[model samples]
Target: MAERQGIGEPRFERERQDDAQASISWLPRRLDADAAEPKLRRFGAERFEPARLSLWAMAIGRDPERPLAWLLAADHLPRALLIAGALDPRPRQDEEALVLDGGRQPTQAQFERWWLWERLARPKRWSLRVQPATLRAVALPLWLGYSRGRSGAGQERKTRLIVLSGLSGEALGALKPAVLAGLRERTKAQTDAFRSGVPEGTPEPG
Candidate 1:
């Protein structure tokens, strides 16, 4: 397992398209055992957990030894939104931007579909800071929290996700074409295997 933690600053920018302001940011991978393990457990659970994939990515980014790849399945998005609302990060309907933090625990699924297209961005968009030593698959749930600015000026929504494993910068770059291609290839393979192993069109008795 990878250990050691560091705090890296994320750069965020606003991208307004079709009258919606979308925000994107990047965080480095520098995480300690205490921080990394708990995160992993929450996100790795088999329950109907709430969480933001972005928040999970941010937590991983805070540590340098974690894998660089994250899989955002469709079933777990509601959990992320509930956490976001509880933290009261305050979604901007005007700008269509909501920055969630990994601090609070959400009860309901909110903002689940706001990021449908965001899932397609799993492999290509994010830039990795550090390479992972090993890749382990685990299911962790989301932990949500909110940090309010003094005098009600602002509030920040926080979320954290612990995953099975990620790709290291070096390991990823060693693949083919480019690092992202490598990550995508690996993720795709894993997903394909998972799908293939599932019983297709099986009916469950009610």
Candidate 2:
């Protein structure tokens, strides 16, 4: 069983440099969702603005729960315009001097081939990004066994793009707020850690 860790503020530390700065000790809990238990897996994703957020369908960064949340809210976007974040592990350096490296893929084909396919098949040490919005956009309704009714947000669309089961509108409201908050916290933590050039304090795996 995964060790039961209490819910609390993520670990934080301050470096004694030219000035004092605080950073959260953060690392993704589960990287591969397909290999791990459902509850423990995390999706590596950030930037949750409307239709602009795209996550690795399987990348679990500091937070394991963001991917599914993103997938659920993804249909709100235009197309494959989701901002996919790459999760290349930074090299170890003196905690005070370590900087978060820029994770950018040069081309979309490269990102699609290397990050999505090869990584999925081989399970090697690599990172990029993924998205389930389109897949989920269709899959979720079918799985739930409910077609989108013509009344609320999903009205008039061919995909019947609305919830039909869980929430009041058959939607997922609760999950979004919590997941969005988690993403925000993760972003802040990463930025602070990088700015301080401190190796991350501790892994906050869920």
Candidate 3:
């Protein structure tokens, strides 16, 4: 049986994507006892819970030592707004150019559907920052304080995931560093993979 202590960060090294995936045939492995586990001192809302943490633990727990290859076919999308350097650079309407040319993207709604997509993005688009070492995820926006960690002008963004695991203050303090380190390493590898497409089966970290 796994130890009852907090989780620990698994050993990890970088490897090619295909080789990594080849090692993991089915699901991501559960974490080993060596992995650091943070204590949960408090609760924010009802959504973040041990179940969520367990899910996260299960997802990357596989081969904690191998480098992480984040599959981002749908992640880190640019905002629909035409902000200068925001998510997407396209104009508010996806068809400004097309309309100018008297045409549009092949759609049945005459571009209304595309417009609707852009409309809905604003409310749901909560920018999130990936926590390192601990393998925990955090939202970056202050408005999202309720769901993610609370952050404002002066506050450093900490994780709001402690409640999920029901850890105490001491456990939270102890687990902070481990979680940050793991998350940072994971995020770094993921960012690298996002920049360059990895092979199908990259090895996962322990």
Candidate 4:
């Protein structure tokens, strides 16, 4: 009789596509679908007409159950596009920052947001030369799941993008504003950190 493989056994060979999507698990929190549609539509129309207006989102607190909304720029733009997902240990490195193996082949939407966010993050090095309105043309959605601090049961930690079994829009709406605000602040801080070339007052990247 043949011996059966254990649960931990490698079942299928890891395909590139499979690995690409796997990185999305880093931010597995369900995006605000209801808000996403309207925000994308409204912003799509007002991306330009002005400059300096940008998008922001951030996470906060120890073991945060959800993201906090810190800032929403008054600037508007085209609809934000949803991409497959963002890869881990960002800044893909190849001959010179090439996409990594098993990395998600970003759609057109992903390309836009990726370019914009990266520019925003390193404004000193990168340029915000594009018109504000055109910024909307490239915003992409990233669904992610990640864990901070300790793991295992009874762990003092936070898990993002968990599947809510039966939460209604109304229930989620109650917390939307705060969450969005927190996310905005977090986003801004991230960009600023990159600009400062010292995230959280840490050493500059070499």
lDDT leader: 4
Candidate ranking under TM-score, highest first, comes to 3, 1, 2, 4
Q: Each model's TM-score?
A: 0.19, 0.18, 0.24, 0.18
Give the winner by TM-score: 3 or 4.
3
Cα lDDT, model 1, residue 7? 47
What is candidate 2's CA lDDT for residue 151?
67
Candidate 1 lDDT trough over 10 residues, lowest sum: 12-21
In model 4, state the lDDT of residue 19.
36
Candidate 2 pairs with clashing backbones: 28-61, 42-60, 42-64, 44-59, 54-83, 55-130, 56-129, 56-130, 57-130
TM-score, model 2 to reference: 0.18
Sort by lDDT, best first. Answer: 4, 1, 2, 3
> Alpha-carbon error at 162 in model 3, in Å?
2.3
lDDT of each prediction vs. the true structure? 0.27, 0.27, 0.25, 0.28
Candidate 4 per-residue lDDT, tens place, 38-123, comes to 43333232111100111222211122232221111111212221222121123211221111111113233333454456446656
Measured on C-alpha atoms, candidate 2 has an lDDT of 0.27
Off by over 4 Å in 4: 1-166, 198-206
Residue 156 Cα positional deviation in candidate 1, in Å, after optimal superposition: 44
Task: Write the residue-wise lDDT of candidate 2 on 68-157 in tens digits.
Answer: 222122222122222134332222223221122111112223334434443466464234344311111111111011133346685573
Q: Scored by Cα lDDT, where does model 4 land? A: 0.28
